[model samples]
Target: MAPLRIQPMPTYMDIHEIPGGITADEVAKAHAHDAAVEGKYGVHYHKYWVNERAGKIFCLCEAPNAEAAMQVHREAHGQTAEKIIQVEPDVADLFLGGSEVNSAGAVLLPGGAADARDPGIRTVLFTDIVESTLLTQTLGDDAAMELLQIHDSVVRDALKALNGREVKHTGDGIMASFVSAAAAVRCAAQIQRGLAQRAGEQSNHPVRVRIGGAAGEPVEHGNDIFGSTVQLAARLCSHAEPEQIVVSSVVADLCIGKGLMFRPLGEVSLKGFDRPVHAHSVEWSA
Candidate 1:
């Protein structure tokens, strides 16, 4: 007989969009109501984020399914989420960070115990050295290491300036997360321009990098960020040409009116994704 497979409870992040704006106190009350009724549907409401200025509320929960999670909200406070996406616990934690909550169940900023709230959204960026293996073969290990060092320094500098957190070093490049999509876009442009300047200074072993970015809420899969957002960012990076920056439509839309120039690439097929994803190329050169 075949062995039975047990399905794990799925984690979900739900977004509530309030037009004018919402207060932390109001969200706290709604969360209390959710907690009161979640048990009935076997849903566990973990933590929530309130962006008063953005008029957005994000709730993290685990339930049998998205519908079950939404049912809890309907029963609890009649505040249904505008959208809900299934996420992995670890990925959600990576982007959302520590789970410290106040007395009202709202998540606080990593170290800020005072009334500040985390918005629960992040823009993930990936940078890859174009033809890294070929470069290593042509330049040998020592020279390749030097090129990598240059890439590291330039990317780190831009990250520091833009308030981006380096998630991990990708050997040939870096992976970072930012609170603002515009900042992420700006950082990518800076990295490209910096590399171009460096190439001009050094004729031999010119380093060219490809960058990609995508914006979304926290979703986890494994120890690293293996969510769709991260995947999209990585795929876009791979799709980019040397010295080019590619980003998802979501990232481009978020940067609207932010003075960033992007040429739409229409929809492009990517690996591991069922449908084609809309992409844009950032014009980062002078």
Candidate 2:
């Protein structure tokens, strides 16, 4: 039997908070642009509402996938989305669950439902050294250690500026989390750009770093993140070129309608995963 299709199309939608100096009329034009792109992709876009208090415009769209939907938002709008969330495959039906079904899905005794599940909405970031093994072989332990210190200094400051929480360090790489996916993307980009500038100033061998990030539910345990989703984000770091940021569809969706840019790399399967994940390379602002 063929699988059931829930939504007519897969779309990434969000609520964008308009930056100061932008008028509602301007936002309407941007929304119209997004509508046109959705039509080109064979999807319908629904303009939900305009928040007068917070100065935000909310929209819902349907597209081929999250990336395509995000592309529409990024290309069409210049507003920063406060929250871009996945509507989920079958969110409506899930709400139909009664008390018995709901209780059955609860966490183990005393753990509560929270412990068994992640909030399902978080920004996951991965960072790692570039050419560490070769640098270690050539520069030896002493010099390599010094470079690592520089790497730490660069990322640590970027994370702080972005208000990110340090989850832990995976070898030379660090896994961090942010409340906002936009901040995570911006933070990673800033780190890379900062390191590049710092490297140029130093006369010695310049150390470079690569970063990867995703936004999704990572199993949370006592103020730390765990589970396969987090691992996938960490592994994505290796796939990134030096000074580049690779992010998953999850993160891509969360940044929709934000002024941020991205260049799609299509999709690729990560190790120990059953399916391929859509990934993108962050496009730096001009």
Candidate 3:
């Protein structure tokens, strides 16, 4: 089955504390813009309530990941949330229980059942050098080593600028995680552009990197994250062409207003996934 046929899941939820208070008109306006902004990135948002006395608002959204939800909030009104959290797909149904079952098994109703799972979301990024073996053969060990160092410098600079954490080195590449999808996408584009610039600056080894991004609930164990999301991101990197940035449908949806453009590649078979994944190629130049 194609991913488009599957039910959409609510993966992120956040509570914004409006210390100054908010109005119905403001909520209505935000919701109207959100409907358009988030749909491009592949999510849905509904304003639940406005606590006038406490000056708070609760919002529920179905997003590919936490970054997408946060992006919508940030670009919509500059009201970037203080904290955004991941909602377990199963647990989402617990709060929205009324009649329609949320992606989570729980129904939406009064005194809704509480979900036991933890909530938080992250965007995982993976990148690798293209044809390293061939490059090494042509450039020799000493030249290849220097090229590797250049790659490290460029990527490390991007990580620092975007506030991303380098999880580990995957020999010819690296795996990193970000709190924001916007940041991750921005970092990936910068890395590509940076590498292109370096290729022109140095005449020795012109290296191109392939990048893949996916957002989801990632379980952190030590320095590494082990989950379907991580695996999915890694698979995407492997499938990408040199200097190309590939992303899942979730990533594409979350990145709608972030200045990057995506060209749809349609639903394609990815390793391990039972259904075809909807993938996109980031059009960094345009």
Q: Which residue pairs collide in model 1, if any?
A: 88-220, 91-220
- Candidate 2: the clashing residue pairs are none
TM-score of each: 0.71, 0.56, 0.57
How many angstroms is residue 17 displaced in model 1 relative to the true structure, after the best TM-score fit?
A: 9.9
Model 1, which residues run further than 4 Å from truth? Answer: 1-23, 30-47, 51-94, 97-117, 220-226
| Residue 66 displacement in candidate 2 (angstroms) | 36
Q: For candidate 1, lDDT tens digit of each residue in 66-85? A: 99999999999998988788
Question: In model 3, where is the ten-residue run with the lowest total lDDT?
Answer: 103-112
Once model 3 is optimally superposed onto the true structure by TM-score, how far is the C-alpha of residue 263 displaced, in angstroms? 1.1
TM value for model 2? 0.56
Better of 1 and 3 by TM-score: 1
lDDT of 2 by residue, 1-286 (tens): 9999875665444556555534445655776677766666565565433433445554555667656666676666644455555554343112111112122221121122542321225577889888888889999999999888888888889988987777666767777877678888999988888778878888587878888887653222211222455766776777888888999887888899987899999987788667888999998731
Candidate 3 per-residue lDDT over residues 133-221, each given as its tens digit: 88899889988888888888889899889977787788888788775677888999989989999998985668788999988743322
Put the candidates in TM-score order, highest first. 1, 3, 2
Error of 3 at 164 (Å): 0.6
